[model samples]
Target: MKPFDYLSPGDPAEAVRSVARNPAAVFLGGGTNLVDHLKLGIVAPDLVVHVADLLPATVEDLDGGGLRIGAGVSNSALAADPRVRERFPVLSQALLSGASGQLRNMATTGGNPLQRTRCAYFQDVTTPCNKREPGSGCSALGGWTRHHAILGASEHCVAVHPSDLAVALAALDARVRVLGPDGERTVPFTDLHRLPADTPERDTVLEHGDLVTAIDLPALPPARRSAYRKVRDRASYAFALVSVAAAVEVRGGVITDARVAFGGAAHVPWRARRAERVLRGAPATEESYRAAADAELADARPLEGLDGGNAFKIPLLRRTLAATLRELVGEDAR
Candidate 1:
């Protein structure tokens, strides 16, 4: 490991100033992903600014029936909060479905959405990965691609974002509060992550010295009936091959409102806007669910690679989305 300078900033503004002054500096929160990258030689920052103590750690109720979640709140705490489980069950379920108990205990809400992809080529320094080094070329394009993107992919990169929490947030329309060198601002959670276009190395819109302070969940009543479902190779500790986070409001056997998002399908937590548009005011039936899934996946283009490709993810994602919508409407999802 390369030697580096460490700073435990007493204030968030101080932390921002310290990191903004030096582009080579990075803010450290929980050190779950960043530490691993440090040891793997993926990232070697000159300065590490610890912000765990500077950020808020409590979950507070907003006046309009929403919730203000501190960025420093652990995944375990967020999932276990009664308010979260009752008001936004999808978020809780999504958080619980990820990682493990020990990791959840240490992982912060702010840091969870900022996680990098688990693409094997991107992690192996010996391999050529566009995401690791932009112009070096993409190994996933011709290598193992069972976990790669099927939607919104470009020639530069096909890796998928690995964040269950982010999918739930995208469905809930949560907003992220960030403090940076330019000062404070709020960003829609859906816009937090950027698709890998020409610049595959940049994962998010966040700039240097930008610190996520908290996440704001809106007063979404439909989310009370929401749920998160993941289909993976294993029961635990495995990233989703296809995951769905959905919230539906049904009245008199018709869908009044709906929100849907998919994970492991694209470079970002893909908000199924087309599917949501189809679901609104539609009948709450399997036919309607299938239609919604079809509308969203009409343009999906799965890639071919050494591991026989990930063409299977397209159908698997369609089935997963349809089943999740069925389950939400109290139907037999099977």
Candidate 2:
């Protein structure tokens, strides 16, 4: 690891100013992902601005409804919070379904969503990875892409994001609050993560010097009836081969509203807008679910051949989406 200076800012403004002044500085929230990146030589910074004291650790209730989760809040705390568990069960379920108990206690809400890809090529500094070093070219495309992207991926990169929380948050219509030297601004959770266009090196749309402050979730009634499902190589401590986060509102056996997002499928949390369009006003049945899943996946651009693993994703996505909707509707029926 490279030697670096550390600064523990007492406030968000100070932290932002410090990072803005030093372009090589990055905010140290939980140091979960940042630390790993540092060790892997993926990132080397001149200074680390610790922001634990600058942010709130508790979940605050939004006056109109919903919840304002502090960026500094631990994953375990967010998952176990009464408001998150009751109002947004999908978020809670997604958190619990990731990593392990120990790691959850250390991962922060902000860092959780901004996790780097687990693509072996990206981590192996000796290998060529667009995300790690732009213009080097992506090795995962022809090497091992079993867990690569199937949607919103460019020819430059096919690495999938590894965040269960982000998929649920996107489905729940959450917004990210960020603080920077310029001031504070709000960005939708979906907009925070970007598709790997030609510039595959930029993982997020966040400009340099921007620091995540908190995450705000709007009050949505259907979120109370939501759930998350993940299919992985192993039951524990494994990244999802495919995952689904879904919420459905059914009235008189007919779907009134629906939200769906998929993880381990794209560069960003893959929002199934096409599926939601097909689901609304449709009957809460297997046929309807199948149609919606297919409608959304029609745009899927899966890679081919032995290492691609994209072919398997097609069937897995359908099954996961279908099963998730079925489970949500079944619960509503009872």
Maximum-TM-score candidate: 1
Question: Least accurate stretch of 10 residues (summed lDDT) in model 1?
Answer: 325-334
Query: How well does candidate 2 score on lDDT at residue 105?
Result: 95
Query: Between which residue pairs do clashes occur in model 1?
Result: none
lDDT of 2 by residue, 53-144 (tens): 67878899997678999998999999999889899999999999999999999899988999888888888999998888899998877677
As a TM-score, model 2 comes out at 0.97
Worst 10 residues of 2 by lDDT: 302-311
Q: Give the C-alpha miss distance for residue 49 in model 1, angstroms.
A: 0.7
- Candidate 1 residue-wise lDDT, 104-186, digit = tens: 99899999999999999889999998898879998888789999999999999999999999999999999999998999999
Q: Relative to the unseen true structure, what is the C-alpha lDDT of residue 156 in candidate 1, on a scale of 0 to 100?
A: 94
The parts of candidate 2 lying over 4 Å away from their true place are: 305-308, 331-334
Candidates in order: C-alpha RMSD to true structure: 1.5, 1.2
